[model samples]
Target: MTTASDDQKLASWRAFLLTYNTIMRRMEQEMQDEQDLPLTWYDILAHLDSAHRGALRMQELAESVLLSRSGLTRLVDRMERAGLVERHPCEEDRRGTYAVITNRGEETLFQAMPGHINSINQHFLQYLDVFDAQALLRVLTKVLEGERPAEGSQAEVIEGDQ
Candidate 1:
């Protein structure tokens, strides 16, 4: 037994899900084809390249990449093994660790930028007017600021909050 309201909500949710899935799949494919990098890895490198001193505290890196801490640690482990990034002790804080992009990581991002820009333009920017893009930024910011699970997700780690 389904009501019209339920059907409408379902439709709306489906639209959101499909949008996310399609964009991620296309972005991943484009990055792989042009850069030999996964989108997630590129995101990490991009964040580092734009960061202060091309490095960030581990917790900060995880939050910036929108990954749970453990997830980020695993990602970093893989990147470290690939020679794209390295982790070192934080100078100011003995308990803290920093993720620093290696020279290889910088080169990887440089190689990826043109393809990334083209993909972004084709799949994202060209579809939106400037006004819409600004509005979308605001909307996404609001969503990011929203509350998370009180207990946090299982995959989440209780490290320093970002």
Candidate 2:
């Protein structure tokens, strides 16, 4: 039995997914057109830059960049060829490997970051107001963490976190 609330939830879910895809596609296009950089590469490099020693273990990198291990391996290989990243053995676990960001990678990320930020702000953040942004942050955080916020936590979600 589908209630009005249930229908609304389904619509909300679809909206969230559609909006996410639209934003990502636009960002991807912007990155490629303006910076001549693939968004996936930019994402991987950005994650690595913030990681300890500008590197992450293969599995960790895959998880951080939301890629399958094999997919990440292929991309890393291409990046290595482009002198943007390199792979090295993990001393702690011989079976593990780390993907280290090269100097070129850091340089590329710095160059691309400014334009990417502008694109994000223009395409997505521009639509959100202050309290709406705050409320969204709270909601997304809860959803991502798979945990409900505390009692009265809803009250703390301001209208403008975006």
Candidate 3:
């Protein structure tokens, strides 16, 4: 009962998954070998480092990193143990907490940035020309627009439940 359009969509989805997994694996390996950093840890550090005042509320950080709130909490716990980040209780909201990048986290991110950029350039960006990059940006932006959670939707509910 599948139509031609369904077949095309399936193929595109599979292709995207394959490319994403391949590129991420290569990048992860390169990062581990060159800087002894895991991509997830690097991602967390990068997000925290880029946030205003080098911090973000736990729920916001979870959303930014595409992690479930519980997953983010566990990851933050691990990072805190490593002296990479710290949790600060929010003054305005007693129930809320912020993740703040530490000096060690900043230093680690600075160390890993070169390898990360090189991995992107070598594995991904080099495959695109300017026009292709623009087209990709447009396509991805459109896709993300649809995927983003609605205001006060399940995402918010999940954050509150956590």
lDDT of 1 by residue, 1-162 (tens): 999999997896798689879988999998988778999999999989988889999999998889999999999999999999999998799999999999999999999988888888887789899899777666555454455545444223322322
Which candidate number maximizes lDDT? 2
Clash tally, candidates in order: 0, 10, 0
Give the residue spans of candidate 2 off by over 4 A.
147-162
Q: How does model 3 score by TM-score?
A: 0.87
Winner by lDDT between candidate 3 and candidate 1: 3
Quote the positional error of residue 13 for candidate 1 in Å: 3.9
Q: lDDT of each model, Cα atoms only? A: 0.85, 0.89, 0.88
Instruction: Summing lDDT over every window of 10 consecutive residues in candidate 1, give the lowest-scoring window.
Output: 153-162
* Stretches of model 1 off by over 4 angstroms after superposition: 1-10, 145-162
lDDT (Cα, tens digit) per residue for candidate 3, span 12-82: 89998999999999999999899887898899999899889999999999987889999999999999999
- Number of the top candidate by TM-score? 2
Instruction: Tell me the deviation in Å of residue 15 in model 3.
Output: 0.7
Worst 10 residues of 2 by lDDT: 153-162
Whole-model alpha-carbon lDDT for candidate 2: 0.89
Query: Can you tell me which runs of candidate 3 are displaced by over 4 Å?
Result: 149-162
